[model samples]
Target: MQQSNAYIIIFSVILTVVLGLLLSGTSEVLKPIQKKAEELDTKKQILGAVVPAEQISRMKAEEINQFYESRIASKVVNIAGEEVEEQDGVQVTAENIDVAKNYKKAPEDRLYPVFIFHEEGNEEAANAYIFPVYGSGLWDNIWGYLALQTDMATIEGITFSHAGETPGLGARITSPEVQQRYKEKSIYSESGELVSVVMQKGEGKDYSGEPHKVDGLSGATITAEGVNKMLKNYLEHYQSYMERKKEGTPKMALN
Candidate 1:
């Protein structure tokens, strides 16, 4: 019995060491692939919101990189629309930016990244804000930016995508139709009332009183509900930002 017990203890220790080494080795081997995939996926998501998928699909990776670098500056801006202050002052360059694992829980030294999607020399430049939007979806989360029209309410161009939504159902939130709906719809009224986006079960009515309410998906009721909630929350989250942007001209430098 003693001999058997001793053998068992020895075998357990050996097994633990072998399993630890194997796991460590496996993690090291897959680290590069994992990192590359994450970077690629992040680029794809950001690009999807920056340019239409069709536009990106037609271009090569290098083209995408070039176009991305030229039009959009991947910089971090605070919710207040200020250049995120860093160890120096406000960070206008990415080099001065501090990196973080998660934007929601970024370190005190790090600025939450809000990629500026801009069109250079465009007349609409006057209206641009460091437009940032984020929200929780059914399965995970969804977020994006809006290079909205100068009116502070009208959407000029929008790029959106989501994360971990059920494949066909909840995933439709990323559809072009969903993304573009904001273009024709009004998020605010002329009376200065704040109107949040909504998703309905049946065909929605006219735009004046019903611009926000979209048709909720048939099967994925929960996802539809999530979309509605996400839009409402994220829009509210960026209320201060939208209020700070210009309506007509490049409103005399930001206060």
Candidate 2:
């Protein structure tokens, strides 16, 4: 039997509305779970800056959060490395800080998140300082956490992620091999200048012999350069904080 056009239109409208309602209801019901999962994912990424490559993927969400809370001290800092108590009366914390949002603001106005990982029992001193950095990649945004050694000049580890980079090329930024390249690299010159680590062509040099240069992805030059720029810009913002640490200042060290 052939349906009349009016009847078909009515049926289509009802179906569309029903489907839309169902989707909306599902999203609303799952919103909390989704938010929890996102929080867990961010925790895992932050952990990635400290955890070993083999263990990062194997750790559960609960374990990640446990380690994060116990071993990490998070705080917000301005460009001058001073801890910020509140911005417009809203407390600034590591979990609450939106680094990407702050990036759009002026340098002094930006509030950066810093994660200090220390021994479980000793929160007074940091073993390393992990910083959050983000910038444009080949396709979209790329971001990561960079862990600096207690000296606040050498990189301990890195973990990068992207919104949409080509597979096997720019995407290699997240690979263990690529990330390993950043380990032990120096981000400052001996003269106290902020000369961030560079991504050079080809397999590059042994970082132990050449501290500031690393092997970039073979075919992902633009993405590699993006990483370079992102690191330099973000690290510069923390240089004041780092200098204070080197001088035995109590801003980030005591808390």
Candidate 3:
């Protein structure tokens, strides 16, 4: 009886393994379509930042793809903020390819891509800089894209998307009301120092009631502060690049 029971358990375990393998294989088969969908969704989210409300309401996936092909150029950036050397139209990828991986330290050098977007058929339109941002919110990582105009002082658009942040509080990053606060923010001092808009709690937010000073999240103080810190860190590292580009005249070069 003991031997029979052992054989039964072994067979059951083998069956389970086989079933798992079959499911995994199915998932692998579906992964390309899944990845395409995710890429499409990401584009939509980024496009949503600048797309007006009425247009966004009517935006379609096919339209986004067409616009992407015509108007967006993606280049893999190295840790040094240099465009990644490409091979056969594919950007190189390897271990430690992302500078954000070394977010805590002054990265010696790292790689992160920049997305440039422009209007289709606009012969003189300047491309904008769009970078991905990730930082801890009150409850989880708040992730989003920050897009800067050629001047870098004038923000083209920003979209904040968070996971697991409290509803009606930290989650307000996704709110258009909150996002509009980022428009026209100068990340540079007039003397060319790195600085983005600062978020302060309660009574300290509005200094002279300028539009640039956005209010802190009332109940979600931590998340608001997280936005401030993350931008400070990321933009500081990007200062050298911004300054050089500024000197080069971003709008002309973007063309």
Task: Compare the candidates by lDDT and give the number of the best one.
Answer: 2
What is the C-alpha lDDT profile of model 1 across 1-255, one tens digit per residue?
657988999989999999999999999999998976665555555666546678777887667656656666554545554555463653355423323233365323334455555676343344333344565667776665554555556655455556788887778777787666656465676687777666776434444456656566666677777666655655555565567654424454353
Q: Which stretches in model 1 have alpha-carbon errors above 4 Å?
A: 1-16, 29-33, 87-112, 120-132, 145-147, 156-163, 203-210, 247-255
**Sort order, TM-score high to low:** 2, 3, 1
Give the poorly placed runs of model 3, Cα more than 4 Å off.
1-4, 7-11, 78-81, 86-90, 93-106, 121-124, 203-208, 250-255
Clashes of each: 1, 0, 4
lDDT per residue for candidate 3 within 1-255, as digits (tens), equals 657988999989999999999999999999999988877777776676566545755867788788766776666554455656664686564222343354544454545556667778552464687766667888877777788888866677788888789998889888887877777766666676666877768533554345346667788889899888777766765666666567778457656
Clashing pairs in 3: 78-110, 78-111, 79-110, 79-111
User: Please, what is the TM-score per model?
Assistant: 0.69, 0.92, 0.79
Q: In model 2, which regions exceed 4 Å deviation?
A: 1-5, 204-208, 249-255
lDDT of each: 0.59, 0.87, 0.70
What digit string (tens of lDDT, one per residue) describes model 2 on residues 63-138?
8888888999988888989989898987778888877788788888999888989899688767888999988899
Model 3 TM-score (2 dp): 0.79
Residue 24 error, candidate 2, Å? 1.1
Which pairs clash in the backbone of model 2?
none
